[model samples]
Target: MAAPYLPMSQEEMKKLKWDQCDFIIVSGDAYVDHPSFSGAIIGRVLENEGFRIGIISQPDWRNTKDFKKLGRPYLGWLITAGNIDSMVNHYTAAKKKRSNDAYTAGGKSGRRPDRATLVYAQRCREAYKEPPIIIGGIEASLRRFAHYDYWDDKVRRSILIDAKADLLVYGMGEKTIIALAHELQERRAREEKEQSFAIDLQGLCYVTDTVATLQPQEVITLPSYEEVKESKVAYAKAFRLQEQEQNPYNGKILLQQHQDLFLVQNRPSLPLTTKELDAIYALPFARQPHPSYANQGGVPALEEVEFSLAAQRGCFGGCSFCALTFHQGRIIQSRSDESLVEEAKELVQAPSFKGYIHDVGGPTANFRQQACKKQAKAGACRHRHCLFPEPCKNLEINHDHYLQLLRKLRQIKGVKKVFIRSGLRYDYLMADKKERRRRFLEEICQHHVSGQLKVAPEHASPKVLQYMGKPSIKVYEDFKKEYEETNRKLDKKQYLVPYLMSSHPGATLHEAIEMAEKIRDWKYMPEQVQDFIPTPGSLSTCIYYTGIEPRTMEPVTVPRTPKEKALQRALLQFRKPENYELVYQALCSAERQDLIGPGSKKLISPPMSQKFKNRKLFSDKEGRGKGKGKKRRH
Candidate 1:
C-alpha cells in the first residue's frame, strides 16, 4: 500500500530500498502525515514528483546530532516551523509562556526553540556543511519581508537574510514546492562543481546585493529596511505596496533595501487548479499521524481535522487582522464534488471512523470558488476587498456547489452526519441575495452544526470593525435575528458562538466596554476569548506598531503600554472575579464609574475585601454617586 506513510526513519528507508533521500524536510511540529500539516503536504508533494524525501519533525535544535539522524541528502534541505509561527506557538498574547502546544505529541510545550526556522537552518548547516537550505511555512512566509518582531520589540530584517537560507517559498506552497524540487534537481546537476547556486523563482524571495538583473519596470524597489524602521510613514507605504503586489497575474517583482542588500519577493504562486487540488488531497496521506506517535497519545492537533476534508483554499473575506491575503492570497480554489465524495468513501472505511464528519471547509466555509468570474483571468483587485465594509457589487455569491457536496456526503452509506465547524463568513452569507444563501444557512443549522454554529462578529463598535476590515455590527445583528427566526421555524434551539477579540488596535477601553455591553445583550460569555496578538506581516500589525493604518496612513488609536493593553482585555471579561481590579481601574480611568456599581447597568460589583478600605482607590460608595461616560468622537 505504497509503504503506508512516507519514511520517517532509517529503518523505513531501508524497507523502501532507497539508498538516500533527495530532500530532508525539517519541521518544528511533530510529524503528522496529513494534508492539514504543511510538512506532510510538502513531503507528499515532493514524493509525487519522484524525489525521495523524508521528514525530520521536531528535532533537537541545540545540537546537530538529531538533524544528522537523517544523514545527508543528495539535493538539499526543505525546512519549516510547522503550520504556525514559532513565536506564536511559544508565547501567549500577554507574552506568557504557553503551557501546551496543540501541534506537539501529548500537547507538550517548549518542544522546539523560538524562531524555529532560523534555529533549524543553523542546525542543518552544522550537520552538513555544504547542504543547501530552503525555508517556508507560516513563520518564514509572513516574515519574508522586513517586519516588526513583536517578541524582540523592534523591527527585524527579512527571515531569508536572518535565517541564512537560500530561498523562501511564501504562500500555499504545493505548486511552488513541486516546481522548486524539479528546478533544484536540474540546476544542482548542471552546476555540480560550483560553490553554490542562485535560485530565481516566482512565489519565492531571497536577498540580493543589487537589482541590476531585472527587466525595466518589472522590479519594484520598496523603502529600504533602515528607512521603514525609522519612519512609520515609510513603513506604511512599503506595507501597502506589498499588499498590492500579492496577485499572481498582475503582481510585480517586489524589492526593498536592507542595508546594502536588497530583499526581493517575486509574485505569488498561481493557485492550484481544481485538478491540481484534487490530486493533492487525493495523495495517500495515511490520513492520520505516523504510527510511531501512537504511544505518545498520537497527535492532538489531528483530533479535530483527522477526518475533516479541506474543501477549498484561500479567502476573499479580507479581514485586515488575517494574514490569509499574504499567505494564501484572496483567490478561492476548491476540489470537485466527485473527488471530495470519493474521500468520504475512504473516510467511512477507516476502523476508527465515527459516523460524524467533523468539517468540510477551508479559510471560509461558504467560499467555494472565486469571488467573481473575472478574478480568475485577471486577479483580485489590489486596492479593493471582496467582503469588507461591504460586499463588492461584482461579487458572485453562490453556495450551491458547497451544498451539493454536503448533500452527497450525507448520502454516503456509513456517514450519519457531516458538520461545518470551520468558520463561516457572516457577511458573505448575508451578502447573497439569492434563496440558496438562506437554504445554505438552513442546511448548516439543520444538519451541519454540532449544537452551535460559530461566527466572528469581532466587535460591536463600527470604528473598531473598520480598522479590522470587518463589516459593521448591524450586519451581525440582522444575521442573528434571521438565524433565530430560522430556528424558530424549525423548532430547534441551535445556538451561535460569536468569536470575540480584545485589545485590537483602534479598540480602547471605550470600545471594549461597548462590546461587553453587546455581549451582555446577547447574554453570552464567550468560552473562547481571542486576545489580539500581532503576528508578523499582517495589516493589523502595521497599525499596532506604527500607530498608522497601512492603507490609509491615518493616525490610529493603538494601546501599546502593558497596563492599557491589560485593562482593555480585562474589560471584555468584566464579570471574571480576577479581572475585577483591572476592570475597576479601567472604568475609573475612563471615568465611567456607572459600569462598576451593583446596579442592573453595572458590569461588575465592587470587591468585598477590607483592603478596599485600606486603599483609597477602592471605595465603599462604588458609583453610588452616578457619573456619565465622557463623550468621545469616532
Candidate 2:
C-alpha cells in the first residue's frame, strides 16, 4: 500500500523511492483545502484508481529548486486549474479582489511565472527530455479558446497551446485520468522497454513531435474562437433550441477567432454520490493559511482564514455570468450533515482555528436540502435551472434540513461561530414576515450570518431583472426591511449585503437611472459591483451579445461598450465627482434629463451633491491647466 500524504515533508521525499510513484499532480492552488475545487476532487479520483499520487500545492514554479524537488514521477504530470487562481495566470495574476479572500500569489503583472502546465511541461522537458503533461480543470478547460478572463480582466486564448502541455484534458477528468493511466501502464507492461513503448502515446503529444506521427483516430474537433465569439444571433441560431437539449455542443458557444479550441465531446462530468462526497471531505486537510506564500498586495486565499467545507455540489441558479451550470451541472447534490459536522469538529480543533467556520454551503448555498422530488413523477424536469430569470413553481423550498444542519453545527464543541457567507436566495424564503420571524428569527440570529446576509438582486429595473431571471427590487427591499426589523426587535445587530450586477442585457440608461434612485434611497455604498462577464455556456451570454433570450424569444437592450459599463458601475458606486458627471451625462444623453437632480423620480443616476465637487480642486493643475472638460455621453 502507498503511504498516506500526511505530514508531507522533504524528509519523507528522502526516504521514498521515486520509482514507486505513478503520477504527480501539480496545482496553482493549495491541495485538499476545499472539496468543491478541481484540485481536491480530481486528485482523489486519480488516487482511487490505485495510482501513486503526490501533490505540489501553491507551487512556486518560478523557483527552479521547488520545481526540481517535485520531480519524482513514474508516469506523467497532471496539472490542474488550481483551488484559488485560474491556470492561465499561474505566472501572473491573482483573481480574488482583496476583499473576498480567495486569493494566492503568482508572478508580477506581465510576468506570470509561466502557466503551471507550461512551466511543468518545460520542467518535465528538462528532466525526462520528453514526458507527457496533461492539463485540465477550470483554467485549462474554460481557457480552451479565447474568452474573457476576470482575473486578468482581459481576453485570452486556448491554454493547451499556450501552456504547451502534451494532452489538454477538458471537462471532468475523473474517468479520463484513470483511462490515461491504465493505457500508460499497459504499454509499459507489454513492451518491457520504455523506449519501445513510447509509440502508443495516443491523446498525447510533445512540443518536439508532429501530429502526423499518430495513427488516424476519431479526435473531437475543437470549435474556433471566432465561431464562439460570433454575433450573439448567430451563436443562438446554432445551439439554442429545446429540441436540441441533449446536444452538449449546442450550449457551448465557440468563437471562430481563437486557436487551440478544445474538443469536449464524450467527456464525462460524472456527478458524485453523497457517500463519495463525504469520503472526499474526510480526507486529511491542512487547515492553516500559508502566510509564507502571501502576496504583498493581493487578497489572501479564504482557505487561510477558516476551514472551508463544501456541504453540497452544483448550482440551480442559471445566472448569465456563471459557468457552473455547464461545468458542475444543474442538479444539487449534498454531503450528509453528519459528514459536515465531522469536518467542522476537526476545523475548530485545527491549529489555525479562528473560532468561526467561514462558510458551509455550495453553489446558491441555501438550496442545500432543496431538490424536486417532483422530478421523479415529472421525469427529470426539463427546466434549465430552477432559479433562473425567476423561481420555478416546482422548486421545493426546504430549508428545514439546512436549518437542522446549522443547528447541529452550532453544537460542535470548539466552534465559536458558524456563518453562511454564501449567496442566500431570499426569494425562496417565502414565509410571511410574521412566519419568517417565528421560523427564521433564531436561525438567522444564532447561525448563518457574519453580521450580514448576502442576497443577489442582480438588477432593480423590471426589464433588466426580467432578462437577468431575477426577482424584483421590491421583493429584495421587502426582505431587507423585514430582516432589519426582525434583527432590531430581537436586539440582534445584523444587515443584508446585496450583490448588484451592472451592464446586463435589457439595462438601458433609463433603467440604470431608475436603479440609481433605489441606491440613493438606501444610502449605502455598495462595496461590490459585479460587471457582467459573459462566460461560455450561460444562457445570459447568448442574450448578452444577441440582445434576445434564445429560449424565451424576448428582446433585450444590451450595453454595447466598455465605457458605458464603466460609467454605469461608477453610478452604482456613486461617490466621486467624475462618476456623478458620468451619471448626469448618461441620463441627459438618454433624454431622461429630469433625472439628473433625482428625488424618487425613478432616476438611475443619483443627484450630484455640492460636496462631491468640493473634494477636488478645479484649478489648471488639477485638469492640465484648464477647468474640467464638458462631459461626453456615456
User: Which candidate has the highest lDDT of all?
Assistant: 1
TM-score of 1: 0.94
- Winning candidate number (TM-score): 1
- Residue 125 Cα positional deviation in candidate 1, in Å, after optimal superposition: 1.1
TM-score of 2: 0.76
Q: How many residue pairs clash per model?
A: 0, 27
State every prediction's TM-score relative to the real structure: 0.94, 0.76
Q: Write the per-residue lDDT of candidate 1 for residues 1-634, one digit (tens) a residue.
A: 3557878889989999987899999999998888999998988888888899988989988899889886898888999999999999999887889999999999999888999999999989889977678899999999998899889988898998988888898998887778778877887778775544444667888777867877758877789889988988998889999999998998999998888888888889888899999998888888877888889977788998888989999998888889988999899999999899999899999999988899999989889989998899988998888887789999998878888889999999999999998889888888887587679778878888887889999888988999999999988989998888888888899998899898889988899889988887787777667889999978999999999998888999987766667777777777666666667777777878787656666787755655542333323445212332332111
| List of clashing residue pairs for candidate 1 | none
For each candidate, what is the lDDT? 0.85, 0.58
Looking at model 1, residue 526 earns an lDDT score of 73
Q: Write the per-residue lDDT of candidate 2 for residues 1-634, one digit (tens) a residue.
A: 4344411344554566543456777776644344455665666566666766766665555555554555556777777746433333332212322322244443233222434556655665565544467777765654554444444434445566667666666555554566777877776667544433232232222232233442235232233445545544544553353112312222221222233334222323345568867876676544433334444443245443356667886666666566665555556668999998988887777786877887878777677853577532232244445655456666777666777888898888887787877777777664324564457756766566777788888778888887676767877888788777778777888877778888777887777777777887887668778877665446666676566777766676778565567557766866554555656556556777666543554434443455533333223233312334443232
